[model samples]
Target: MNASDQNALVIEGGNQLKGEITPQGAKNEALQILCAVLLTEEKVTIHNIPDIRDVNQLISLLEDLGVEIHKIGDNSYAFQAKEIDITYLQSEEYKAKASSLRGSIMTLGPLLARYKYAKIPKPGGDKIGRRRLDTHFLGFEKLGAKFNYNSDHKYFEIDAHDLRGTYILLDEPSVTGTANVIMAAVLAKGTTTLYNAACEPYIQQLCRMLTSMGAKITGAGSNLLKIEGVEQLSGTTHTMLPDMIEIGSFIGLAAMTQSEITIKNARIDELGLIPDIFKRLGIQMEFRNDDIFIPEQEHYEIDRFIDGSILTVADGPWPLFTPDLLSIVLVVATQARGTVLIHQKMFESRLFFVDKLIDMGAQIILCDPHRANVIGLDRQIPLRGIKMTSPDIRAGVALLIAALSAKGTSTIYNAEQIDRGYQYIDKRLQALGANISRI
Candidate 1:
């Protein structure tokens, strides 16, 4: 479990996996909700939390800030931020941990709301492209906060004597930015209106949890939100929905490997456009109550438009297809009976990993930095596995899926990138009868 370990995954391909699996809690939601715990001094109990590297590191950072953490179980915890010491944020040890994950930037909002001042190191995460923090800082400034960047220390600092809520429109529907601004505005002094806000399930969950903690928030699952700031917030218990990205990855894995698998307790309602998008790629899935069942198939064909044009799968903001699942879709399309285009509009560099797929004997044309054309082989020629390194969380899972359906053994280096978002992925895959070993 050491973060510094050079881990790798050795996967044996061509296995017919079967059984039922349940996804862990949503990692994206847990990051936002965990940061929101800093808004109150009372103990907040959170259930269905994912035990992943990024979440664990964020919890450690919270502990450094003097938050009292109690482990209720493997998937539940109680967090109390009564005696937080803000000074620790400037220390080298704190900086090292905070700069390792992008979730650490979320701490700025709560700290500014509760203590009137905050310091944060430049956050780090998957280097897909330019993930600008302009929306977050602009929203903070709109709420009457002063922002400054320290060039020497490579950090950001903000101070607000009295945060006054006002109407602000974000340039883009940035999920983390919206969450940060909403958390700060909840305790501000006036009515705050947020337009063009992200309506992802993660943001909606964070808003609902805040509402339970005595914050007045309206428009839970919409692009517009209204928050009337209160003087204080109390603690509340919240449970995260299942990780939709993980569920999508499982579906791709099942289809690629010709496996019959059921994803239990998938929170089907929250998964907007995911299942339908897979259906567009000719993936057959049945909704058995709350679970999704994918049966083994010899072949699944991609659906074209009514006019017989090639279907292109692109990513965008909420209510549209998420960028996280595009990688999985690309991998699944490799074995389908038709051609499709995968467009990753959000991050330019994400499609670079397709080179690895092409090297594995798949037919992929790197259209550009944002698009790739995948021509399905109809499983006529199975993919030959080769050694490669994982680039990011989504692509890591995509590579794993490709490896599972490949014709030979494959070894993936930089397995920690996969571990960052997935919880015990190797063990879980092994439970489903996949031959994957971690070393």
Candidate 2:
């Protein structure tokens, strides 16, 4: 659903939202963790699972694979892959379901590791940029898996008869790619040393959970990871961290709306560089235990480089600001007091949403597909709401933020894109006094 989808968000803009909002479980981490459940036959109890579209879609795909799924709570599930239907991998139904969301790509590692065969249609998600599966297939090939792609059917398959681990130096530090390789390596016969791995908190959480399931893994939060393959794994209960991307988005929303909002259970210790990066935008936030207190501000200023140069906010590997939050940052800068360069180095098409913001009266120069120069209005002229369409998940949320701060009402089409990542976003924002409704 790109723009013609009937799932739209009608937002009455210029409302100063208040109260506390708790973020849902981390969506990125949940995808990898849920796939990891396939590695062990025991019951894997996972709490803090978000009830979002993509995750739910993946859960349905797991059900198609004959994994025993039991919902223990509103946001908790116990999964047992004891009787996986391997034959389902060849069915047309499996192809369509697996192609619906990009998260299905993670299942390949576990299925190939345990069953020695796995096939999936080319997974789909946001069309922000080109995301290749080379790292995943190349890593698998290094671990004794024969990779094949049937271009006619738009699906790929892997055959792993005898899995043995070896040294792997990834060409790029991709989080999901790293996760797929790690999951496959955990059940290999020999030691697997993975260098240039993605050290995001999501990957670290996966490592911890895999360790609890009897996998021998070291370097949970570093680029260099070593895993001694274990014969089998036992299930264990694990809790997911709050979505840091949501936390960052909430902070941006509070500043954009000038609302006094508190983000509960943000797990600040785990939010590395997020708070400080927002501080770069001059958005003041207070940390009270695990909660983040965002005070209403009439005007916020953007900080410049120490050499009196324009501050350039760029995305890179972890510990650096994330590319996922760059859209939110771009929106937050629209109403800020100064000019800053938003360099979205990761995905070329990610910065394309600025055109919608420009139509809504934002002073943004799309320097190229990769960079944008946002000269803020500083709230002197409030943004005028207009009808727009959400292109992807992060951009959808970013446009929502822009609409919340704009004057008059705004209608956003294709809101299902937003629902893919954020859990009940309209309801949660409504709880915080936002004038938004999903239609």
Candidate 3:
């Protein structure tokens, strides 16, 4: 955290917020789709784009590559990549900006497929754990791209004279890796089959946008995806889905704060397992068409198994509970009426933030790096506000929830971490009666 990042959020807790709010555009999805803009020479207009640090950094990177970007609206933009300067990627300044965001890694596929070569610096984003790019590199290698690592430059260089698609089975369901492989395979010479692929809604949205740009892809929402290489891709307009993670965060916030809140245009059908997972934590939500209405409740009891065992909330790949929301869920469970184990199976360092919650008076047993058991307070005890640092994006929001529900004022340092994913979060929460001020 630098001088700019020294900004903190001061929150007055114990407020019952009541209002309706809509989630911003999907940040993860925008990262992938924006990289896809490099595939076409024509203009691509993307709507519902979130105004955040990561997305803005990526858009700046696009500009450095000579992509003509015009802001059509506050949340819309038009991009044209007809005059890409791939050599700019090798500059020190460009490398620094590229390395500032993890999403910059996605640019590898589009660069390799279009320019036949790409140089990417090691990516930087929320230091949650070791996020490997091996799946992406290996996937590109399967599609006939040669890879080399320059230890001196601390970057990876890939080149492909002829990219011919083939069968690829990823070692893990890496979302960004899947998007990279799909983007590269879409412009290859032959058909591609990807098994054990990440099928998150973001990936599905990326595939749909690619399909609109003239790519042939099947089995979008499933782990197995088949893509037939096309000679060229045309530009097309794409509208992103609401950020499901933010929606889940808001749902958890409403429940933990005992507020009556409604999330508008939630796209409930696409939010697989998210609502049910919250419902398990004792959140009662009603779906009205596309919105979710969560009313104020005095008590919410965690559901137990039919065998009377404590329920465990674990994260897995898509169609399962998203790992991103596990932190939020863990925070919400602190106010519930029963005990539930939070198993964060994906990232190792994610559950380490439980120490912050425990310091704030929540009863949490940190079993290991991968799991924690949270015993609900049942609203019998109000959490005392305490100063803490924001660890990562999801965990930052979780801490914000804890701060809002705490008995007194709490200051959260490293506000930039929260700004990376959320758009004007403090102002948005303030609209709903949250006593938060960004300092």
Candidate 4:
């Protein structure tokens, strides 16, 4: 973290928080949708946008590109890409700003599709694992773009005089890769067939938003997408979905602290398999209309498989449980009655935070980089608070959950990591009766 973002949270543990809280706009969706503004010169208004660090940084990058920006209302902004400042994009200032966050990499798609040229520094994000860009350039190459990696300066460059779309199969179902290719394909010369694409809800929202902006796209919610290139796109209004990962985090928080918490307007329909996966972990929740009410429970037991085997909580592609919430699931299982094997397939380093949890008295066996065997304490022994450092956004919040449920007091360094994805989390949790304060 930079000097501006350096901070800490001192939480008084063993507090049973109560009351209702609403989640912010989906962070992942907002990142992609904001970059989509580059596809048109007309005014684009996005509503319910989260005021998180990553999203805000991307918005600033848009302004640096000469996009007209105005905050029309609370959590809403209007963007107009009337003229892009190509001069500044090649400057040192732009390089520093764009290299700070990973979302800046998505800008290449719109720039290449519209201006026939694009370049970006190698993006930086969580130090979880290797996130590749081959899927992006390979798809762009299939669309008649010339590609080259300037490894000397750690950046990528691509150009095309005329983008002619063609059939391309992604080696992996990458969300951002699918998004980059989608924006590039929407303005190409011919129809592009993308198979084995990621079908995350956020990706669906991107396609739907582009369709609203005069792009012809089919099969949004499935892995197969066909996009017929249009001459240009116009502006449109878009509203983002609630952050399902936050909703899951809140559910874990309620269970861990034994609190009665109501999460309002969660857009429960779009949270495919999240609640069910938490249900298997013995978290009791009631769906009331659009809200989820998790009541306080003295005890909840993990459910075994039908064949009488221990439950294995794992993450897979979309329509399955999302990988983002696996850390939250790992933390919640620490207090449950039964054992579970957490199989995190997406990243290798997310489970490294288990050492922090172990310091607080949770019995976890780090089987390998990709899996962990968690022996739930069943509240037989209350977790004791200790000092630890926040690793990344997801793991940071997982540690916060641990601190909130632990006994006595805990001090967590690098609270800024938590702030990257969540908006004013400390203040929101305070309203819910959590004894947390930033320093």
Model 2 misplaced regions, further than 4 Å: 1-4
RMSD of each: 1.5, 1.1, 0.9, 1.2
Evaluate residue 409 in candidate 1 and report its C-alpha lDDT on the 0 to 100 scale.
Answer: 92
Tens-digit lDDT track of model 1 for 251-368: 9999999999999999999999999999988899999999999999889999998999999999999999999999999999999999999999999999899888998899999999
Q: After superposition, how far is residue 77 of candidate 2 from its true place, in Å?
A: 0.5
Q: Write one digit per residue (lDDT tens) for candidate 4, span 1-439.
A: 5663459899999999999999999999998999999999999999999999999999999999999999999999999999998777688888898988899989989999888888789998887888888999999998999998888998788887789889999988999999999999999998999999999999999999999999999999999999999999999999999999999999999999999999999999999999999999999999999999999998989999999999999998898788889999999999999999999998888899999999999999999999999999999998999988888999999999999999999988988788899999999999999999998
lDDT by residue (35-54, candidate 2, tens digit) is: 99999999999999999999
Clashes of 4: 0
User: In order, how many clashes per candidate?
Assistant: 0, 0, 0, 0
lDDT on C-alpha atoms for all candidate structures: 0.94, 0.94, 0.94, 0.93
For candidate 3, give the lDDT of residue 283: 94
Measured on C-alpha atoms, candidate 2 has an lDDT of 0.94
Q: RMSD in Å for candidate 3, one decimal?
A: 0.9
| Candidate 3: worst-modelled 10 consecutive residues by lDDT | 1-10
Candidate 3 residues 145-250, lDDT tens each? 9999989889889997799989999999999999999999999999999999999999999999999999999999999999999989999999999999999999
Candidate 4 off by > 4 Å = 1-6
The pairs that clash in candidate 1 are none
For candidate 1, the lDDT comes to 0.94
Off by over 4 Å in 3: 1-5
